[model samples]
Target: MEFSPIRILGIDPGLRTTGFGVIEAQGQSRVYVASGCIRSGEGSLPERLHVLLKGVREVCDHYRPQQAAIEQVFVNVNPQSTLLLGQARGAAISALVLAGLPVAEYTALQVKQAVVGNGHAAKEQVSHMVQRLLSLNGEPQADAADALACALAHASHATGGLATVGMKSRRGRWVSL
Candidate 1:
């Protein structure tokens, strides 16, 4: 049986700021419902991770999304920063899993290409396209908007079969959610 449209939450994870957006897919259309960021104050990595986890849990509870899409960490020149960011991402994912939600991961390039039609598009260009495609009323913050764009992109591409398929994993496989 064909399932009803699914709600999806997207996350752009960082140690200091983790952005999040929620979207719903219905037939051929996807709508951006909400977007925001989790701001972690200066603290130890573990403390920041705790904040990230709590923030993600709050988002999940508020949105009640069927699945989540998170941007994979890109290779940064700073190894230490990259590792910390990865930890933050892990915390976010853990929260989703604990909340009984599935998760899908996408690279930065994939997110940019899915939202802007170009993997190498500038941040402003991507943000602009996201606003236009999602039909947002006002400009969203760069990080939050990008997170929402990632969620929308996942919904569109997964529904369109441009990304991964099959949704059996507990972590949530990349499917049209």
Candidate 2:
């Protein structure tokens, strides 16, 4: 039996540029719908957060995705940077939840591994693979490519990509174990 396609929004959250990508998933096949970055500009902390939130909401409103995937924020050497990134990530996740969508979180390593078969793959490698996977005419922007990779990762998990990763789903969200 055939099933209707489900749309997913992928987010690569950042303070300055938050990337978003949308895709339609039908069975095992996935196609890109839209991908772009939200430029929060050089603004105050609250201002930046608001920009991120608003940008994500706009994407949600436009795409009407059933679910979402977000790249987990990693710690940086500078604690300040880490904290700011965490805020951005939270804003992005909140936007999706506010839209009544389930969210799935994946670490950079997991996203890279799922997309390029190497957890340590470079950004250029990821860009190449996403183009191949989606049969795009050219490579997407770096941030947009990362968002697309995150969406692809979530789709991979749905197809039983790896069992050891052990994703736990609850409260309309899927979190890595």
Which candidate number would show the highest TM-score if scored against the true structure? 2
TM-score to native of every candidate shown: 0.88, 0.90
Tens-place lDDT per residue, model 1, 1-177, is 475888999999988999999988876687878899999898887888999999999999998999899998887899998888889999999999999987888877778777777778899988888788888877789889889877977786668645545432233233344
Root mean square deviation (Cα) for candidate 2: 4.0
lDDT of 2 at 57: 96
Q: What is the C-alpha lDDT of each candidate?
A: 0.83, 0.88
Clashing pairs in 2: none
lDDT of 1: 0.83
Point out the worst 10-residue segment of candidate 1 by lDDT. 166-175
Clashing pairs in 1: none
Model 2: residue 158 alpha-carbon error in angstroms: 2.0
Q: Which stretches of candidate 2 lie over 4 Å from their true place?
A: 163-177
